[model samples]
Target: MVLEPIYCPSCTSTNIVKHGKSTQGKQRYKCRNLDCSRSTFILRYSYLGYLPEVKQRISEMAINGSGIRDTARVLKISPTTVIEELKKRS
Candidate 1:
């Protein structure tokens, strides 16, 4: 099996280890980097990302001239994916 690198969302560090599962059963990871402030994180997409309302909101935000970070913060998606989606729409 191939292992994919898991990065800390806060520090983008690859020095992470499996901590445990969240209460919701998602896999949680712990950052080993001393400089990293975040202790644990879940690597799965949030429930909000799957909602139709959020999908629509992303498009609406794009149409309103919101940047990728703005849409990602408001709709809770990755900025790279947001840029890709907006590129396809344009």
Candidate 2:
């Protein structure tokens, strides 16, 4: 078996360890970098909206006059995710 290198998404640090399993049974990892803002993340996200890049895109789409349903359909995420992300920005 080959071991894959896991890096923290927030800090891009390799100093990470297994934290626990997510609700969906995905392996959760914890970042050990002191300067990192985010603590834990999963290697694979089941939802596109759960990704940081996708969240940014959601905001960008909203700023570009995209409706919530449009963004959700384009991004392949739930409309509720778009709404929640927009709410967080406010």
Candidate 3:
């Protein structure tokens, strides 16, 4: 078996360790970097709203004059997800 190194997506640090399993049984990882803004993250997310590209699209759609409902509809996510993302961005 080959061991692959895991890097923190936020800080790009290779000081990551297994935290636990998620509700869907995916392995969750925690960053050991104290200065990293993000503490934990999963490499692959099952939900569209949880993906980084989708999150960026959420903000982009909002900035491009798309309403929350439209953004959510186009992204196939919930309106609450768009709202929450916008709130976080602001």
Clashes per model (N, Cα, C within 3 A): 0, 0, 0
How do the residues 16-43 of candidate 1 rate in per-residue lDDT, one tens digit apiece? 9999887788898999999988788777
TM-score of each: 0.50, 0.93, 0.84
The runs of at least 3 residues in candidate 3 whose Cα sits more than 4 Å from the true structure, single-residue gaps closed, are: none
Tens digits of per-residue lDDT, candidate 2, 1-90, equal 999899898889999999999999999999989999999999889877899999999989999999999999999999999999999997
Cα lDDT listed for each candidate: 0.79, 0.93, 0.93
Candidate 2 — what's its lDDT? 0.93
- Full candidate order by lDDT, most accurate first: 2, 3, 1
lDDT of 1 at 82: 78
- Model 1 segments more than 4 A misplaced: 49-90
Task: Report model 2's TM-score to 2 decimal places.
Answer: 0.93
Worst 10 residues of 3 by lDDT: 3-12
Which candidate leads in TM-score?
2
Lowest-lDDT window of 10 residues in candidate 1? 45-54
